[model samples]
Target chain A: MEQNLQTNEEIEMQLWEYIDGSCPINDMQRISILIERNTLWKQKYDELSALHTSFSTNVELEQPSMRFTANVMDAVAATHVAPATKKYINKSIIRGIAAVFFVMLTAIFGYALFSVHPTTGTTSMLPKLDTSKFNLSHVINSETIMIIVAINIVIGLVFLDSILRRKKEQQAVKP
Target chain B: MELDDTAVIQMVLQGQQAAYATLVTRYQQYVFTLVMRYVNNREQAEELAQDVFVKAYRYLADFKGNSKFSTWLYTIVNSTCLSHLRKRKDETILLEEEKMVSISDSNQAERPSDKMEQRTQKQMLENALKHLPESEAQALTLFYQGEQSVEEIGVIMGMTTSNVKVKLFRARQKMKDILQSRFSRELNL
Candidate 1:
């Protein structure tokens, strides 16, 4: 009997379903009976209902800033920049391949002109044939070719150096 | 009229990229309104709301329609606002500290007392909202201001209907307590 009463008077029964108009007819009757029989419950219901109405009606909802809509639209535009923007990797790889092609052309030009000269060095490319009196050393020492390869090595070193420097910088800046 | 939120969202997912503008126009007000409640600052709320909508557009494909469109949108807005609050520097206030100061002096100075009272009420309400736990505040505000039902609030909050009502009840009770405390002196009845 006590458990049944406790279950019937659960928190949900206090007022929410009644206020929400969600209580079924049977539950509503039970609540009505509770309200009629219990002064405290009736008073609490009146107070909560009034408070809900007061707060809901009296509170002024601040409209979002005037620029809100514009800003969101701008953001949407920015995200879809080209709608179907091409894949970045394809563009980057194409650029990389072009760079390699240019370097290879320069390497071949140097090999033909300087490696065949009757002077300086050995060709890294042709390790087998040595009959021509070409100065492979000239090509080997070819300042332009050396400069290009040296630049590539320097770039690689610079990139690695920057990465290490960045790591050290991050460590130094940590609290 | 702009495309409906669901339509634009669907179009954007289908790679009809321009459809995003329609969605933005359709729901920016609603999103901003939720964000404003959370952040309580116009500029910051707008910025945060914008960021949330942009994120939603990016992830529109993942939005399964388990809830109404507006409810789902607000869920995203609420999450963004909560994150914004987390990143803020203000100390949280308890719900018990709400005070209703008289705006009569301000009205006598220039404006009408009604306007001043309205402004005062707005400030008091905002303060009261800030004091509640984030979920309780969100649930109540969405329920009252957005006119959302228990089931709808439940969907937006990702809670059961009973849970949403519990939070709403607690939130309302807290707000009432605060209001009563603040106005007890001025109000006779």
Candidate 2:
């Protein structure tokens, strides 16, 4: 009885594939023979066939209001026009700038290393550093503080702008 | 001959913005139906469908013509609907409510007996469709109404062709099961 039930389920699945027109041709022929010879198979096939026909005929497509296209067009008109030219960020330009910066940094380091002639008497090529002389008060002047504050404010504004733009893009992408 | 979507896109890019209206009108019904599957609210679905078109227009310049225009538009529709579904995670519309509303609407219209029967059958099928899992419903709808082949449905749904076939098969079986039980209950009553 268990074996028969398993076989029936397999046959039912195959019959569905056949109904959907997704079965292989050989399998389709096999199911056709089964349907023709077996009353149970024939009954199931008939019922499924009727249901499939109803699905094809009865499921109606929902229509939007008459103003749907017009509303979409108006929304498009209010937005920025898509550029005809490529608007994507050019990676090549960015890579080129990065390459130049790297090369310049390497060249500067190479120069500093080559200029450090240990053999040239007692004058060290490295700059003398005195931590005690470097006072935080000197660096914390009004003008310098203002400059640092201005830079932070500019960076913060740019960061906030990018976050807002990304949120808008996300919203636009959602239905 | 009418211009193809590619040609229409080119025209739109070349400063003929009105050319886009043709595409919009051509696809509005299809977009609305697809979005309705997710939202289940006609007004919200219509709004989402319009949003799809507006986004499509805004991003038209990015289209590279690698795929069919309809495929590309359907991709946008799918993602948009999925994101909206994610946002309204707890707010799915009940299938029973949809059935009641549809039946009430049909009652308001003076239909012939045959037409009423047809409407009831259609409603039953729709309710059956709603009972399936979302992926199954989406797969069946895309296969039947979107007129997409299994391969195309796979591309749109981000699944393999075989997976799409399985989903379609399972969806149909589940719909059949639902209809059988529902009809049997009605008969008993």
> Which candidate leads the pack in DockQ?
2
Candidate 1 segments exceeding 4 Å error: A1-13, A36-39, A81-175, B1-4, B11-19, B85-124, B185-189
How do the residues A13-129 of candidate 1 rate in per-residue lDDT, one tens digit apiece?
A: 557678778779888888788788888668767776776676678656656666666667666767753232343347888899999999999988877666653665555455556
Clashing pairs in 2: none
lDDT of 1 at A8: 38
DockQ of 2: 0.23
DockQ of each: 0.15, 0.23
Model 2 / residue B14 / CA error / Å? 2.1
Instruction: Evaluate candidate 2 by giving its C-alpha RMSD to the native, one decimal.
Output: 13.8
Candidate 1: what lDDT? 0.66
Clash pairs, model 1 backbone: A117-A135, A119-A135, A120-A137, A121-A136, A121-A137
Compute the lDDT of residue A5 as modeled in candidate 1.
60
Q: Over the stretch B68-142, how does candidate 1's per-residue lDDT look in tens digits? A: 667767878877776666766367522323312222222234422233244455566665576566577778778
The residue-level lDDT of candidate 2 at B26 comes to 84
Q: Quality of candidate 1's docking, in CAPRI categories? A: incorrect
In order of appearance, the predictions have TM-scores of 0.56, 0.66
